[model samples]
Target: MVRLTPAQLWRFVKRFEARVLIGLVLATGALWTFLNLAEEMSEGEIDAVDRRLILMLRNPADPSDPIGSRNVEEAVRDITALGGTALVVVITVVSVLAFLFHKKRIHALVMAGAVLAAWASSDLSKMLYGRPRPDLVPHEAYVYSASFPSGHSTMSTAAFLTLAMLVASLEPRRRSKALAYVLAALVVVGVGFSRVYLGVHWPSDVLGGWCLGALWALVGWIVLRALHAPTRGS
Candidate 1:
């Protein structure tokens, strides 16, 4: 087994951090490009698009529906199930496990902090947007919160992506890391789509959720990496 010396680990982290920073910047630029384009569209155009999408998602029976019919009940059940809430619960469990079971205080703190920051950002955005959930469909499941961005989508992206990233970091083989990434993408997309299918959020709402979620996850990841890295001159 090859154990990296403290200096070697620190140097590796520096290189990793620089690469991550560059990736994060590029992602932010892409998100800004999307939002700018969205902002540039005429109000009428935007409204027309939103209305059409909402009607298709929420009022599936509308004659012009493009996405086709879906069983809202099943979608509601799936969206509101374990996976939707798993991020928060799992993060708590992992933090406890890392601290108590694994006896790694720093690692536990890093995970706990990252997860909590994501949760806080999601909650804040929900409050700020205060957008109403879709009323076109008979809400088979119940929720009473603002819905500009689906919390499920936001939290799922934050949690699943972060964990997958951690797994990717720990795994040596590229194949294993790629598998973890694919699985993570599936979970994030699945959860986000479930929100729309269940008539709980607008498509734009989910898009915003993904954007904010990814941004915050990147921020959290950077913080975690810095905290986890070996100290200088140790």
Candidate 2:
């Protein structure tokens, strides 16, 4: 076996170091962007795009009338339930238990912690903002909380994305990993859309929730990778 020359080895080391630095910078940028969005939202600044989108979903003649048929409304309600507190709790607990059963205690614990943190963060943001639910249209679903940074939208995204990442990490095939990510994304998007369609959350609320949820999921993924790395000098 031939060993590399000193120059070649030095170049390789520099490339590896560069990659790590780039990754750190990207993560920092993402965190900064999320914080900026939250700050703007907390200051009661509603973007025009958000208002237009919400209005489009409502009947132009009557804001009280949502623009969907009865069956469609029923389907949307069912989809939204997937992101409700009851279902989110059940899914998280079951997923954690399943991870433990597979002897992945670290993964189980990480998931549990990530979900709890996400939930607490959502609740705290809601209280801090105290933004009320949308009244432009009659709500199709029952709601009883401050609405900015929707809890269902945030929790569903965080929980489902974490689960998807965990599943993808275990899969050896590229196709399997792609499928897992796509499915997770569809679930998150559908849940967020359902909230707006049901007239309970403003478009901006869902947008903020999505941003925060994605950030929390990214943090979970990073933590998992760091934990799985071999200790230095090992």
The reply for model 2, stretches above 4 Å from the true place, is 1-30, 229-234
Which TM-score value belongs to model 2? Answer: 0.85
True lDDT of residue 209, candidate 2: 79
Q: Look at candidate 2 and tell me the lDDT of residue 44.
A: 55
Evaluated against the true structure, the overall lDDT of model 1 is 0.63
Residue-level error in angstroms, candidate 2, position 41: 2.6
lDDT of 2 at 31: 59
State the lDDT of candidate 2 residue by residue for 61-150, as single tens digits.
Answer: 988777889898899999999888899899899999998898888778768877888799899989988888876778899998898888
Which residue pairs clash in candidate 2?
none
lDDT of 1 at 216: 61
